[model samples]
Target chain A: MSTGSAPPILETKALTRSFSGFTAVNSVDLTIGEGTVHALVGPNGAGKTTLFNLLTGFLTPSSGTIHFQGRDITGMDPERIVPLGLARSFQITSLFEQMSLLEHLELALASGTGLTRKFWKSVKVLGRFHDRGMQHLEEVGLADRANQAAGSLSYGQKRALELALALALEPKLLLLDEPTAGMGLEDVDRTIELIQRLRHGRTVVFVDHNMHVVGSLADEVTVLQSGQILAQGTYDAVRADERVITAYLGESHA
Target chain B: MSEHLVGTSHLETAATAAPERRERAWARPLYLLLALLLACALPWFIYPPIALDILCWGLFAISVDLLLGYTGLLSFGHAAFWGSSAYITGIVAIETGMPFPVAILLGALAAMVIAVPTGWLAVRSTGIYFAMVTLAFAQMLYFVANRASGLTGGENGLQGIPRPFFGMELIETEAFYFYYAALPLIILGCFIAWRTVHSPFGRVLLAIRDNPARARALGFDVEGYKIVVFVISAGIAGVAGGVFSSGHGFASLNDLMWTTSGKAVLITVLGGIGTLWGAMVGSGILVTLEDYLTTLGFEGIGIVTGTMFIVIVLLFRRGIWGSVQQAWHWALGKARLRWG
Candidate 1:
């Protein structure tokens, strides 16, 4: 799928997943090159999130192969895959409800540093990660609210914290499901900026319904419809495709 | 914008100024010292046997709390560990003539060994399923202990289980002496449980408890944490059982009964679920009340305990210690505002 200097960082071949009799994700091929920001945009129930789950190893594919950094990660548990430099953010906020924002970042840092298994040391000793956690908070513009309980954060702020958590993992490939979902215009802009900042040296595959977010952030966009890719190209070219306009965007937008 | 900043900073200051670190550090140790003093003086106020009973049960309850309060893993069959340890400790003492610490250690080890497999099976399931599996395993152990009369004394139980000694007969020593002897084990058990819950590993357990799926997604081995905690909790429960057997000089079928597990749960809930010390508090209160009721010739003391448990559950959703801690924090918040 790539003839350039670096091979694709992640690739999927003939990925298919079915729930009972309903096929949620049909056989699909995907190639994400190193350091590329690829977007998976689709209308409601278009299997975008399903594909994300399959690629991240959260959901097992009925028949397919998932290759991450050229290693077969098919049916691997998400916990195992994450340590190999793949991390994901949930569509919904999934921060620890009782933990403060700083603690949430520290938990991620602990995983990355292999400190979570250290039973004898006090969590306070992981204060070594304090400055880095604060840096993440600052990156997400949440420095002031680092001490606040994560559950008390506003919806948009929670999404930002979720992004900070993913970033703290320092994954080689980042998967964000609806990184800016259900946000106000101002929050959308902030999240877009955060994504831009995060994409400097990382590979990213994100799912979003917002076309503008996709167009601005994604170097290449894949249009999915009814569990299959309808089109894949540069955002502008994909938007201009007649089938995408009719099947996804509708003639009104066209 | 300047005024807004001032207001937010004021709130933050008020929130963070609860108590100084030095002062907060002293609070726990000070409480521990006071608790030790009280445990020392308890035999003077109450009958020595009752005092010893409270301390033993207190350890058992705290062991249960390690799983229930901190990790959100509730076992309805904790008696499998406690009772099995009691029997092992008692048999070891009677046959091997080992010292007190060694016997207890062996018993606790046996309990932990059994916990490994049960925890393996139990942690694979969650919530009610976990509870049911534990209960089922405990019931099987209970029947096994019952049928193995040659080893466990069957339904009659292992009676006259000898206590450990330095050189002389320790069981023959005054109950007060034995009470003092048992106090350190209880305190040490509590300290171990406290330290584990405060460790970074403990934080991972809390993370798993709060959201297993999210914790797993964050690259934590959720089931692994659960099993390790289960083993630790079972080991502590075994310690409690060993102390109980030595103190009572007996190991019986009642120790392994499902009701014994229920009692541990009730004690934890009554005192407060998440607070580690709440288990001991609950045990003290429940045991004292039951003892007093029985002394008063009340045949159905269970009714009174049941009623009190209902009231505690209804009124104190956070349990006694949790509510008390909340109130303490609130008071500190108020004090900080007034002084600052």
Candidate 2:
């Protein structure tokens, strides 16, 4: 529950990534301040997802470093980074199709506590898990659908459950990859309310193509294009800039 | 009944329940007593040698099933370890005269030693590649066993392997003593396997089988876990093979052959892939059927067993035990829907 004008919780120093002789991301330096809602907005294929991947250990950077709380964490695997209080919900809904939504989060929450698969003997003592898990489901307004198959949930409810599982981690830094990616207007409004509630005491870095969400919730905005930082400022400043308009809008904004 | 009310969603709820963990606590020892009674009767009704042979083979299948059903890694070359241990156990028992159990320990050590190197490679891959790598390596072990005449039996195999059970010079009149002697080893082996499967470590293995990448993301040492289980599985197979050598009083290159591995695979498939006891049931049905068919002057149990494999594959993805589980669920589900 860190707060205030403290140092950036996550920062990339000249981070670069190349794949199969193609430069997917190049020298994209970004900073996400502690307990702030940082939005990364870009067109499709603008390497926002690639930057998210690098930050979250889904992809290794070709060069440069990532620092969390001023410690160089470059090239660390996702498993190791998790114990350091960084957790991420997936871009694609990667819920176990066969598992119930409650089961999915219970297992996630259990593992997030650094519990390994063996020692199933402690399964009898899972009362704390249920209590905390139900609280998380309540947070994202998914308490009613707690027992549903995650895959069977409507597109928006699935996203909400995914958010609830991320909340279960109680992470210092949360990476939400398009948390409201495919939702109805009502679902999107609920997601915004949920996001607002989550922005205190924990840092949130999210990527979305939706300008409206970004404009409303972002404390600061970083715009990416082809893996490089195209612009960085407050939402109004970046949205009003002619460069952002010309670079991102193409013929549509004109 | 309340469990069924949640419907398919309850499958996870039931699986995740705190109270259901106690179900298997008592069931295991009950099975052990039943195994003891069966072992006692093996020598009573059948020739001691044949019954002893079945026990050894059955234990071998059980070991393979641990890897297949519980761990979800289908190994086609378990014979490499099982066969090699038979030779080692056969050689050591004759050379050392160091009691039966001690010799079996040495044999298990040998198989475990081999598994470290081979399993390191096998666990690096998954699915069809895992099976292929294991099968290829086993064939490699077979060739080495065949050519190494100085240490191994070269084709003839080590002979006159002996076991002193109950402080008596084992006599032909008491060939059934082989069954009696191998009983404790089989029981110990099965008990450990069952215990390990029921443990948290086994659940992790199931998690790995269902979704390995997720397990990795959750901070599991996925490959390391696989290699450890591989070695343990090999050790169990080794002990089973060790018992086989003593029962037959011989161990040969035939033990190391690919067909030796295939036999275990055949039993696993016929019994059901992921059902551990189903493998045991498979061994019982297959071995007994072969014995019955041979008496009827029908030498080709292959054609019949082969057809059974196809039918089982097509008819039930859950295999024998799994299908029974699925049907029980479907019935319970229907009953609940009606009542509710």
Candidate 3:
């Protein structure tokens, strides 16, 4: 395990979330070190998404304490959480369908700056963000489709745009839910490369089913089954765990 | 196979290339100039009072469109702001004898103040719940106005709401004179709506409308934006209401009735939801039709308007202006293909 000398960027103590009477996530503790690429891997119904929801404050935990950058952020609203250097991407590709790709990045950029409150000014003021917006689109290889509407993009392209939007936030801790969930082989490779290039100084916690992605990019891997962590270590160490094999990896990778 | 693929791709590019160049026709300088000229000539064509009605209702409809079209909010209690502004303007004109502009401003301010609490409660809900909440608030205000007869003149309404002189004795409170005086304020209100939707703030509103969850994840205060827009819309509606009451020399309980709120919604839907200028077009058609039918001693105006609304919805689901915009782009694409 590469739990290096770096401090923890995010920590959760006894996080639990239940719906109706069924518990989706049950008393799980997690620590993510600063500037490390971490992956949460498991089979279907492993409660990985529920954990993400809890972390991002989309869903309030039934019982837990979440500390980010050494501050208590438990039960904070999603809108409030994002400004505190925590940003997340949805598992489903959510975007403004009628808005152009450049407009999407420009909006993300505008929200960070105080330009969103300038209702009286002409839209020409947004011209200042044009260069930076295009740079973001170029990062995802979508510069050519800058003016095109988000609804017209291919599925793989939409996934790339999603990453671009999250990256635009410049978060201290980034949470991505299934970055390459439905991508083809070529797109998967491209995304893996993009994440490798982008995760230089940021802490990234992603949930993925692809072992190949986990093997390549993740510095540390955590395996969860039935809402509890079964194992946590480096890629090879987690892969070699006996319970992980019997529960998840054995069936999927067999 | 490669040649066939290349040919199909070329066709696709041609089809998609046209729309990127097609700007909104209503926003063009030439069209705006034409519209301005038409506004200047309207009083000559119709009864001066009817012309004033068109201008006032146009501003009201545009205010409704600002929330309904851009923000994806459907408020059914807009009449609360409109009617409240009318009453406030009437009272100010009667009590202080302030300049008409000052009175109108105060009325608009009052409407914005009322919107704060009402919008705070209403924006917490979505879809039909939002509409119902706004409607409930309006109904409550209607009852309050009914009971407060000393202030509001109760069922008889506030009469003798004078249109104060504007320094020139020749410019009296005649319908024709008043129509010109009110035209600038209405235009200013419309311009504000246009500027709002085109600004960065407006871009965020569109994003919230399309996906509130995504907008919140992006760090936007979604409810805050809704409340702010709701207040601005109410303020604009108040301006319309102020002008309407002053021009008619009366403010009645009918101004605050739920049907007045419904009229704003109907006019917005009749023109086009998201198209800012469509509100004015819808307002013009509605006001003109009502005036014409009433002058002919016809009481079935609702049936005619209802039928027209159904036909518009069935034929042009995007409403009149939205469909026209689509067709304009399509025709431009066809022309480009044919010429080149």
Candidate 4:
């Protein structure tokens, strides 16, 4: 993918992170093509989340480089990285529990316009973003709950809201960390459908334990084991690989 | 179509929610007006100096609330701003003979300047560490004030802070007159704070307070918001301090002590940590009680206030104003159920 004529939207070279003596992500070289949904699949301790953290600038890599749209973004702060068209949703849902869903979307919308820093102006000025915020909420099937506090949302709904928030950023490269983790079967289907709709015009990198979600949504799949890439190719190619079956798929499939 | 039915139902729910939201909104301005009237009449009921004390302390508590309640920053060194402003206001008044308002402005600006470095260092830490860092800074300032006896009046305290007239012969700087004179500025400060919390900036602060990591991911400079709020809070506290010192013609070491910071925090918790109006309520109760006890020759006022604090915490976990607001909403819900 990196060797293709069209430049990759996101690329990582020798990406590595360690916590004291324990290395979480070791020498990961990843390349994600534009407008394609990429899945990072691994077992529980396979360093998928740590790799996401490094890519999104949440955690600084011990030794590595991250490039977004050909710009070096290694060890940059999350706040700085986001403005460059990279956004991520956490594995565990994170939100302002007391704020209404619409308010959350409005804040995300206002963030892009540089209006979130205006302490002197009345919040009424954000009324301009109201319709757009509702549109984003509607996209995630959350428009009906727009007025409710985020804390009142169910597990599935909160994950949907998190997706809505990341989408509000209008990021060029969207990262989803275990987007279907802990979701019900019904919710999992809805989320997969939601991601399917969202996959147009942007690059997506997601970590998931659900092979079904991986098969349906992922155009390319990278399987990891013990902080190293075990297989990288199309979903079917990676699924058929012997190392992946023995290291990851064996336990779940068996 | 089914879509039409869903849309109509959504509108129906929205319509039902609107009136309750409006009713709650309308209650705020009305309560504010009533409070204003009560504040205007307070001097007539009690000693004017004590009334003035209530106003200053009320503003102080509100400043603390801006950090503790809104930004989720617990500052234990707010006395640095309050005391520094008091000392600066006194010094400016005595040396430059500037109008008290100008002096107060400079004092507030000084507080903001101090906050830049203090907040920059302190905001990098969270929770108890943030509080400890702030307390350490305040203690440093306190010792500096003590050691620099030549400027800060050392242990003697800065005295004879004049309440300069506002370019009119009829205006007086007496406690009663000054209370009315200062009330407008205090109201303006309160208005600034109110506008701040309701502004986009305030929403970001709330977002940061709720989940800093998520906020950062959303492209918000969470540390920047914290520092900005910290400085703003200090400036407001500075205004209160300047007014307090000028009102009494005294800027004492007590104003800068860690105890003073504790007192402001205690009052905020008493009133309701997050409610702006609660600061005033807490201040009124605390200042009035202190005055009443002093008049009765009671030396151990802390004992009574501490016990009250414990009881309030146990019974009203959200504080007095918070509990009252909650009950009001609960009653409103019940009334709606019955009437509608």
Candidate 4 wrongly placed segments (more than 4 Å): A1-6, A249-254, B1-21, B24-26, B166-173
Please, what are the lDDT tens digits per residue for candidate 4 over residues B1-340? Answer: 2111012222334323422334656877898889889989988998998998998999999999999999999999999999999999999999998888889879988999999999999999999999999999999999999999999899999978887775653344567778888787688768878888989999998998899999999999899999999999999999999988988898988988999999999999999988887998889999999999999999999999999899988999888889898898889888988998
Best by lDDT: 3
Q: Candidate 1 residues B234-301, lDDT tens each?
A: 98899889988888889999999999999999999988998888887888899999999999999998
**Which 10-residue window in model 2 chain B sums to the lowest lDDT?**
B1-10
Model 1 ranges off by over 4 Å: A1-6, A249-254, B1-23, B170-172
Model 1: docking quality category? acceptable
Most accurate candidate by TM-score:
4
Put down candidate 3 lDDT per residue, B1-340, tens digits, no spaces: 2111011122234344313834667668888899899999999998988888988888898999999999999999999999999999999999998878788889999999999999999999999999999999999999999999999999999999977866644344578888888788888888889899999999999998999999988989899999999999999999999999988999999999999999999999998999988888888899999988998999899999999999998888888888887898789878989997
lDDT of 4 by residue, A1-254 (tens): 32245469998999999999998899999999888889999988899999998988889999989999989999999999998999999999999988888899999988857787888999888888899999998888878878877776667778888999999999999999999888777778778888888888888999999999999999899989999988898888887888888896466664
RMSD of 3: 3.4
Candidate lDDT values, in order: 0.85, 0.76, 0.88, 0.88
The stretch of ten residues in a row with the least summed lDDT in candidate 1 chain B is B1-10
- Which sections of candidate 2 miss by over 4 Å? A1-5, A97-106, A109-158, A246-248, B1-55, B169-175, B295-299, B329-340
**How well does candidate 3 score on lDDT at residue A240?**
85
Query: In candidate 2, what are the lDDT values of residues A206-237, reduced to their tens digit?
Result: 98877878877888898888878888888888
Q: Please, what are the lDDT tens digits per residue for candidate 2 over residues B1-340?
A: 2111111332344434322112357876896679678878877886677777677777788788888877778898999888888888878877877777778878988998999989999998888999999999899988898888777868778878877554676542267665676688887777667766765566567667766765555555678778888888898899989888877788888888878888898777777777676676777777787787888999788898788878888997666766776676678668878997
